[model samples]
Target: MLGSISLDKTTRRVSLRAKALMIFSILLAPGCLGSDEEIDVFYGEDIVPPRATPDFVLFDQNGDPVAFNDYLGDVVVVAFLFTRCPDVCPQVSANMAWIGNELGDNLGTEVHLLSITVDPWYDNSSVMQNYAYDRGLEWPHLSSDLETMEPIWRSFDVGLETYANDTDGDGTVDGFDLCPDTPEGEQTDADGCGVETQQSEGDVQTMHHPLYYIDHTTGTIIVDRAGNQRVYWGDFVWNADMVLDDIMALVEESA
Candidate 1:
């Protein structure tokens, strides 16, 4: 009788487990657990709002002028970065490279990647060309003088700041930023592009930081064929698959 009771208890447990799984499946099924509006609220459908890629004229690594209007019909991924960035900039570039590789031939044809350097003072055409060659980047690397580059950077909301420091500065910070005037121990944007917006007054403050980096409220922006900003992926850490999904989504929407 003891053995029979043990078997019955085991059977009851299994039955409970099966019931739990069934309930879980029902909860996960579309239109079962929550309404469409509820799902949208939970998942955040407007995270990335589409925006237009503003028109700009910048010289590619080859010294040829490339304009936004020239690539009007193609899907473009624009990234603002500098070759001298020690942290996030390289990661962002690598992420773009991965997206291009994942897309294969679709990159040059269906999509194009544009990288604009914030350090135009040092990242001239030759410097950009060498950096692109070393990284095996097939995309365009564009830059211009500070005077010319400022307007472009401002258009994208990138801020810039410069400081003077020589404590082990040695002119180059690991080939990331060539700003020898940059002060030692000064905090900068993650990408080393420039300074932050809305500076706070300190108890003791002296110099002001110039804005150079883009304030990318939306980590990624998707511009559709109709020239309308259609998708905005705000603060979304990008990956190849996710980018592909975004492209496919836009393509399908256009179709």
Candidate 2:
């Protein structure tokens, strides 16, 4: 179950729809490994990240420049996202929102979260801000031009990923398909959408760019006090309780 928020801010909807499924990284059995003395130092998908996250200068929702170091002294949960992604990313954000709510006093104190875009070409600071606000998000939703963000993606080892909307469940993608979101189970033409697909609201594209909508990377990383990456989960396949346990442990340790 997703945890509840008790922070100073008024309670906000956590999901577009109620009680969305919560996903985490791959799970590990508690006793599957050897015994008492050895510590379960890492959880979910383990990573060998750099001693500290590479410093990044990116644009915030307000179009102002912000850097990674600005969040120093707080353990940061960082993820890469794109606005139009239809899948995993949205759920990931919801999960983070739950975490943020749970953090309460710890937020901006012991913990902070950052989300950078993989499709910065399409998701400018303005677009990103709208996306974050729509989702009732509190963390930074950041981006820059594709050229400026490529190095950041490289440093984090995440590739650009997106998908086209087939609003009518059409077999083909939007741009070349000329039609999109074909009605479910309906037989479609070569374009994979029906003749009326154009009338569908999905036809309109965004302001800055026309990139494919994408799925989230389904990963999150935790950086500790010394700036070392402490944990990483490649997908939302594990448990939030475990994450909370680990995060609280780290927060106390850092204190």
Cα deviation of 245, candidate 2, in Å: 2.4
Q: Against the true structure, what is every candidate's RMSD?
A: 14.9, 9.5
What is the C-alpha lDDT profile of model 1 across 1-255, one tens digit per residue? 111124454345445544543564466587676444322111113323334557778998888898877766766667777776545677777777777766665677777778888787678999899888988887889998889887766655455664443333433232334333444555443223223322334323333332332232324455555554444443345554545555544444434
The TM-scores, one per candidate, come to 0.59, 0.67
What lDDT would each prediction earn against the true structure?
A: 0.58, 0.64
Candidate 1 global lDDT: 0.58
Candidate 1 worst ten-residue window by lDDT: 38-47
The per-residue C-alpha lDDT of model 1 at residue 26 equals 66
Where model 2 places Cα greater than 4 Å from the true spot, the runs are 5-39, 49-51, 161-192, 196-218
**How well is each residue in 151-246 modelled by candidate 2, as lDDT tens digits?**
777666665555665555555556435545556765545444454444455544322223354544446777776666667766556466456545
